[model samples]
Target: MELRWNPILETWVMVSAQRQRRPFMPKESCPFCPGSGKVPDQYDVYLYPNDFPHLMKDPPEPSIQDDDLLRVERAFGSCDVVLYSPDHTASITQLSREHLARLFELWRDHYRAMRERADVKYVLIFENKGDIIGVTIPHPHGQIYSYPYIPARPAKELDSARRYWESHGGACLFCAVLQKELAFEKRLIWTNEHFVAFLPSYADYPNEAHIYPRRHCGSLLDMSKAEAEDFMDGLQRQVRIYDSLFGFELPFMMGFHQEPVDGAEYPYFHFHVEFYPLHRSRDKIKYNAGSETSGGAFTNPSSPEENAEELRKINAEL
Candidate 1:
């Protein structure tokens, strides 16, 4: 595997010939379950190295030569899997509060390790759940990827935050967004002592929701002990909200965006979690055709207010 420069989009694309060979929905055995050689027999939350990682610490030479137009480079990075539980059928909502706390700390530990690496620039914590989200393993788990450079989405967010900070006399953009959303109160799902979950007015998905720290901070390390505990509560509640929305465990792509760990200051950047659920409603999925894929513009057919209300009601009931 190697990284190829996409000049048009001004991004690096991972070219991996190995990922295609990964197992599909396996029928017989699961490496994450107990009694499997892949993991220990006893553990609540565990960190396992990805068996098939796209990037590595010391990558081999690229098979294809680099050209002036097609700039190629070694994919210097790391990917780790954070197993939430050994139970083969456990979901986020099923995990205990103490277990969830341990899982969050496991993610924090990996992030700190990757931050100290000289080759790493950004650390991303994310999870893909449900078969609709193309989850190869049904076992509940999340993954962390340390990239050699800041990813496109996080880079764009940083740029925007920096611009806002400069123009608004060192004011934070994300804080302003949270203030606006809180004032409106139409898109809000829930707000704990330290965090808030809401659907942005300009949500790209029909039922999209976001979790943001109430206090402006660069990363999870900035969170206090109480703040961190509340954050975990918000996470567990969010998953429960999604599961109760459709009366089933909903499939979604979740990612946490924070400050880049390139030994640079990012005070303007704020910590937040963005969730992109694949299904819009019961037995229906929102597909990215034409405008979303070709034109790079997302179109949400449903009303954000209505969708947010649905989740808010379910969240309150639970």
Candidate 2:
């Protein structure tokens, strides 16, 4: 795979033709199952190299020519799969508090380790749940991708946050959003001492939620032990609420938003987790068609207030 620069969009596009051959929903033994021979038995949280990785630590030379407009580079990065539980059918919502705390610690450790690499510029921690989210494996796991450069979305967020900081006298943009949400309490789902989960007023998807730390922190490494516990508490509660909403497992994409490891200070950037659930109702799924895919616009079917009220009514027993 090669990283081709798109001059028009100012982003790097990963061209990995080999990924099409990766395994889909296999009917035989699961690769993530304990003692399946692919993975070891008796492990609380497991981290292993991805069987099909998109990037590498030392990648091949660029395949194409480099010019003023078209530039190509090797995809130098690392990808790791994090198994959340040993059980084959376990879900994040079902994991114990202690287990989830351990998982968070693993996440922090991996992030710090990846950031330590001189070539690594950014680390992304995210999970895609359910078949609708195009997850081939049924195991409860997440993936970490350490990139040589910052991805487009996060770069855009950082730029915005930087501009906000400059204009607002070094105030964090996310912390401001969290404070505003707390004052309104209309879109809030749950809040503890350290963190708060709320359906943002500008949510792009139905029932979309953003969890933010009350204090400003650039990355997971900055979170204290107490803050980590509260963060896990908020995350677990949010997942449970999603499952309880439609009386089934909800398909969603959850990702952590944090500072890049490019060795730059980002006091204006606050760490958070964003959840985008695809389901609009019990049997309906929201598809990102024309506007969302081509026009770069999101057309949310429901209002944030209505969605928050629906989620607020469901008190998921944790």
Candidate 3:
């Protein structure tokens, strides 16, 4: 695998051809299953190295050279799979509150440990659920990738926040957005003491939601114990609402947006979670075609207020 820089877009493209051989929808025994000899028999939460990781700690020299237009470098990073439960059929929403809290704690621990490394610059915690979302494994799990450099999306967010702070006399960009959402209230799905889940006015995908902390924090490590518990509660409730909306497990990609681990304080950056559900409706799946992929713009079919209203009506008691 190698990282090729696209100067025009100012982003890194990872070319990992070997990942094509990874197992897809296996019919045999699950590798993540405990007692299957692939993993330990009994465990509440487990972390293991990805068998086919895109990046490595010590990658080989880049296959190509860096020119005036194109820059190439070795892909240096780490990827780990986090098992949420021992059950093969369980989902994140299905886990008990205590178990879910444990998972968040594990994520926090891994994030801190990875950021301690000299080469690590960013740590991304994310989960891709459902086969339609292209998850090769069906087990209840998430993944963490510690990169040697900050990824493009987060970098863009940081840049935006920094500019916002500079122009607005040091005000946090995300906090400002959250405040606006709260004032409007039409896009709010639900809220608790510590966090709020709402469909953003600038949502890219239908039914996409963003969860923001009530307090301004740079990352999960900054969260207090009480805030952590309330964070878990808010997350679980959001997932429950999604499942209830569709009458089944929702196919979605969820990720945490946090400050970089480059040892610099980013007071402007705010920690949050974003959920992008694949389905636009019960039987329909949203696809990113020409305009979205090539044009670098998103076309949301449904209005945020409408989607929020639909989600708000669901009973998120779980």
Candidate 2 Cα RMSD after full superposition onto the native fold (Å):
1.2
**TM-score attained by model 3:** 0.96
Question: What is the per-residue lDDT of model 3 for residues 1-318, given as tens digits with 9 covering 90 to 100?
Answer: 888998988888888888999977565668998878878888999998998887888888888778878888888888899999999888776788789788889999999998788878999999998889788888889899888889989999999999999999999999999999999999999988999999999999998999999999999999998899889888878888888887988989999999999899899999999999989999999999999999978899999999998898884444
Which model is ahead, 1 or 3, in terms of lDDT?
Answer: 1
State the lDDT of candidate 1 residue by residue for 1-318, as single tens digits.
999999889999988899988888565689988898999999899998898898899987887999988999999998889899998878778877788788878888788888899999999999998787778988889998999999999999999999999999999999999999999999999999899999999999978889999999988888888998899999999999998987888889999998999999998999999999988878889999999999989999888899989888998799
- Model 3 clash pairs are none
TM-score, per-candidate, Cα-based:
0.98, 0.97, 0.96
The numbered model that scores best in lDDT is: 1
lDDT of 2 at 271: 90
Backbone clashes (count) for model 2: 0
What lDDT score belongs to each candidate, Candidate 1 first?
A: 0.90, 0.89, 0.90
Question: Comparing candidate 1 with candidate 3, which one achieves the higher TM-score?
Answer: 1
lDDT of candidate model 2 versus the reference: 0.89
